[model samples]
Target chain A: MIEIDNLSKKFGDLTAVDSISMNINEGEVFGFLGPNGAGKTTTVRMLCTLISKTSGNARISGYNIGDKDDSLKIRKIIGLVPDNVGLSEHLSAYDNLEFFARVHDLSKTERKERIQYFLEMLGLWDKRNVSVGTFSKGMKQKLAIARALIHDPQVLFLDEPTANLDPEAAKTVRDFILDLKKQKKTIFLNTHNLDEAQRICDRIGILNTKLVSIGTPKDLEDAVRVRKTVIELEQVTDSVLKSVQKLSLPNLDVEGNTITFDTIDSGSKNWPIVEAIVHAGGHVNIVKVVGSTLEDVYLKLVGENQ
Target chain B: MKLSKAWLVAARDFKIFKHQKNMLYGLVIFPVIISIIPSAILNYAVNRDPPLPAAGIPPILDAFSIFLIIGSAFVPLGIAGYTIVGEKVEKSLEPLLAGPLTDGEILLGKTISAVLPALIAMYTGGVIFMVGTDAVSYPSLNYYYFPNWTIAVILFLGMPAATIMSVEFGVIVSSRVNDVRSATNFGALMFFPFLIIYILGQTKLITLDTETMAKISVILLVIDVVLFFISTALFKREEILTKWK
Candidate 1:
């Protein structure tokens, strides 16, 4: 449903978003994982037609982002929940949704039904009349989501939807997004919360100015292959340290009497290191090989790119 | 531009304005005070011990009418400030800009939102000021002095042009600043040109006649058109989301 080709955005000498390309299919939850100033928001802005891309091109539902006529058409099919939520403080939650509903030219009856449906679904129906200024951060975030969905757009762009919410609030937003995923919505989610990204996204892309890696969560984890073996010895001697260093494993570290290093294939590679320690007159207290996680892959990719 | 989309934006701002105590008070109080203060002063002057000379009333009345135009110019600054800068501070423009509306449509909507209320309030106060001025000056001058061509030109033409200028000024000022108070303060500078015209009118350097007021109206309209372009440029989503700080 979304096609981007060689997209890059620059502000004078600084490039906010660099050349990157990806396609998001219908009903696919694509998570953009990046740190601060990683151009996640910039990419979303370009796709949502809120900002212009300095170079390259993008299209949503076959409507060009660079074309004025097509930009409006693209906007009609997309709903965005920015990182800030950006809810009107003075307007009531109900009025906020109603105004957006009317902006899309929904009839009065359709407006009423959709507003109530989204509100009830988001668990905000009881507080519809309350001023948004008085709402909690999670409540305001939920209301923003409702406002974006008031017109029932086919594609949704969410930038850091659960950045600052409490655990329960974040879970609520994640659950709501998962429900949308079930409804076959094309969702482009930008987030730094690894767990949230892993839980909600079907496919994930790690970005740092440029698109570093893109794949399923399990696929990304499998690519990193960062099973680490950590051994606690009774005493550390130069011979024992030399014995492990002779292996030249990746990411080697020594903290007090413990030795740690990345194992290529922990099933076959971990035993030699344990035997090496024993031969070097080091008593092994405990030996454990830990599997890699999404964070490991994320940090490895982001750290490598940085 | 889709006017329905514009109206939706305006209606939303208007609904929120209804809930704002400061905006509501500014709407009612400025008009009432502008209408009453001049009428009271004129009445007190006419009832003075010397029974202020009837012959001198014409210039004073002509000059006093400019206050209505000035008052109308000043009124929209607060509303414009709140509507434009309030959104910037709250960061709510992203969602609105993310919709199908164009930049021109959003700017037009905001302009209408600021202009409609100021016109209604100022025009209502204009009527009251006319009636009250007539009540005080009719006996002194031996005739109803209002509803004349000059006052009509000032009210219908000059007032709208000035109000539009104020709103456009608010837009330009809003882009520079992140808060409403700062926007309004900078917007207060917009009235200096109107104040200069009023002072010139009082000094008889420029007559406050129909022809002069009409010319002023056209000049202000030209400025409004120019400022409208600048405001539209500044209000673009890219400039706002990136350049505005």
Candidate 2:
């Protein structure tokens, strides 16, 4: 549903979004993961036509993002939930949805039915008449999502929809998004929460100014070349940590008697570590090698980009 | 531009204005205050000992009537400021810009929101001012000095032009300013030129008569057109989403 090729945006000397290219299919939930200043929001803004791209081409549902007439058509077919929610505090929740619905030229009946349907579905029907200023952050965030979907656009671009919400509230939003996914809505989700991305996204792109990597959760985890090994010592002395540090093993993490490090070659690396621990008078308890996770892949890719 | 989309924007703003007590009060009260204070001064002078000369009343009535136009220009600064900057501060403007509407349509909608209430208030105030001045000055002048060409010219021609200029100026100023107070204060600068003309007319440096006022109205209309283009250029979706502070 969304096609982007070499998209870039520069603010004078600073390039907010570098040459990034990817495709998102219809009825797919594509998640964009990145750190602050990583161009995730910039990419979303350029695609949504809220801001112009400095270079490159993008199309939404076969409509060009750069063309004037097609820009409107692209906008008509897509809905955006901005990072800040951007709801009118003075207006009631229902009024907020109705205003956007009217902007999209929805009929009176369509507006009423959609507003009621979304509000009720999102558990905001009880607060429909209340001013948004009085709503909780979760409620306001839900309302923003409803406002975006009021016209029933084909594709939805969500920028950090669950950023600052409480865990429960975030879960509510996640569940609602899952519901949208079930309905086969094409969703482009930009998020900072790694777990959310892993749980919700069909395919995730780890971005840092450039497209560092893109794959499904398992595929990304499998992309990491090195496995991690944890040596559970019966009693870790300061000398054991010092001995392991002397070797300068990658990603060495120690918690009490347990030490974990990235292992590229298990037989060669583990024997040396066991010798170091035994020489330091620490008894071997448990040694295990574990596969990498999405966090590990994300950190490795984003860290490499940085 | 699709005017229906513009109207949707204006209609939403009107609904929001119902909750803004300050904007509503400012909209209603400025014209009322300008209308009454001038009439009060005229009434006080007419009933005084010498009863203020009959010939002196018409020029004074014309001078007082010009306040309607000045008030017309000043009244919408608040509404215009609130409508544009309020959205900016709330960050709600992004979704609107992200919608299918064009830059021209949204700006036109805001212009309508600012112009409609201002014209209504000023026109209503003009009515009250003309009736009050006629009631008080009639005994001395032996005629209703109002309902004349000069005041009509000011009301129908000069006032609308002034209002449109103020609104467009507000939109331009709002692009650079983040808050409503700053927007309104800076937006008020557009009327300074009109105020200077008002001062010139009061000092007899320029005539406040029908022909001169009509000429000034045309000039104001021209300025309005020029500012409209500039304001639209400044109101770009990209500029607004990216650069507006």
* DockQ list for all candidates: 0.87, 0.88
Candidate 1 Cα errors over 4 Å, as ranges? A233-252, A276-285
TM-score of each prediction:
0.96, 0.94
- Model 2 sits at an interface RMSD, in angstroms, of 0.7
Q: What is the lDDT of residue B37 in candidate 2?
A: 86
* Superposed Cα deviation of residue B25, candidate 1 (Å): 1.7
Off by more than 4 A, model 2:
A236-256, A264-282
TM-score of 1: 0.96
lDDT of 2 by residue, A1-306 (tens): 899999999999999989999999999999999999999999998899888889999999899888888989988988999999999999999999989998888999999999999989978899899999998888888889888899899999999999999988898889889999999999999998999999999999999999999989989998785688989988778888788889888899999888988885654668877888899888998888887778888899999989
Model 1, position A214: C-alpha lDDT score: 97
Highest lDDT: which candidate?
A: 1
User: What is the C-alpha local distance difference test score of candidate 1?
Assistant: 0.90
True contacts kept of 1: 0.88
Docking class of 2: high
